[model samples]
Structures are given as C-alpha cells and as structure tokens.
Target: MPTQNPRVNVVLDNFLYQNVRLLAEKDNVSLSAKVRDLLKEALEIQEDIALSAFAEKREKSWNDSETLTHDDVWS
Candidate 1:
C-alpha cells in the first residue's frame, strides 16, 4: 500500500536516534510520527519567537500620536 502523505528521509546520529526511538516507544507511536510531531512543535516555537521579536521591534517604534481610534478604523 502507498501512503498519501509526503515522506521525509533523515539521518540522525546514534544518540539522537536512540532518544527518538525511546520517545516513540513511550508514546506508543511510530518513529516517523514522533519526529513529525517534534518537528511541528519546533516550528511552532520558532514562529512564536520570530513573532515576539517582530512585536518588540514594532513596540520600540510605536507612536501614540500617529495612531487611530476604533471609530476611525471602522468608519
């Protein structure tokens, strides 16, 4: 049978492979699933960090006098 989802092949060091295998066994999921889940989580965290940096940069350059009120935006 063929899988519908895309597949990724990765090469991990022995230590990392062992750790991921252990985690998969603990969670009762396949190694691929465990790696996929971890990748998703890591990407989310990276996105959050990037967003936070952007927000902080925006905050540093914020000007209240040049801002608009809620009515101004709606109307």
Candidate 2:
C-alpha cells in the first residue's frame, strides 16, 4: 500500500534549496523526509546533551575526592 505524503510549501533561497536537494539525493530520501529526519536528529542530540549534563550533576554529588586516600593508593 502506498502511504500518502503530507503537502507543505516552504520557501527557501535557491542555493539552500539546491543544497537540500543534493543532500536528499545522496541520502536516497525525499527532500521532505530528509528535512523531517534532520529535525528529529537535531532534537535528539539536544536531548542527549541535556541528559549528560544532568548526569554530571548527579556524579559530582557522589564523587568529590580528587586525591586518593591511603587505602586507595595502596589498593
């Protein structure tokens, strides 16, 4: 079954449109799908960075020792 594609009209500069078209060809995806994929990827990357920052905050609360104790040094 063929799925219906949504219709959207976006205006871009000629150069930008050409670049998008080239990327679409290289990736073997329709321009619309490529744009949607790119947006999703960007959002996911942003979310990952935010989660990593939150993890760093949690890690700092647990581990504060920069210098090793005698036990640690011996072990």
Q: Estimate each model's TM-score.
A: 0.85, 0.61
Clashing pairs counted in every model: 0, 0
Per TM-score, the best of the predicted structures is 1
Q: Write the per-residue lDDT of candidate 1 for residues 12-75, one digit (tens) a residue.
A: 9999999999999999999999999999999999999999999999999999999999999999
- Regions of candidate 2 where Cα sits further than 4 Å from its true position: 1-15, 63-75
Overall lDDT per candidate, in order of appearance:
0.98, 0.88
Which residues of candidate 1, in runs, are more than 4 Å off? 71-75
Q: Against the correct fold, how does model 2 do in TM-score?
A: 0.61
lDDT of 1 at 35: 99
Instruction: In candidate 1, list every pair of residues with a backbone clash.
Output: none
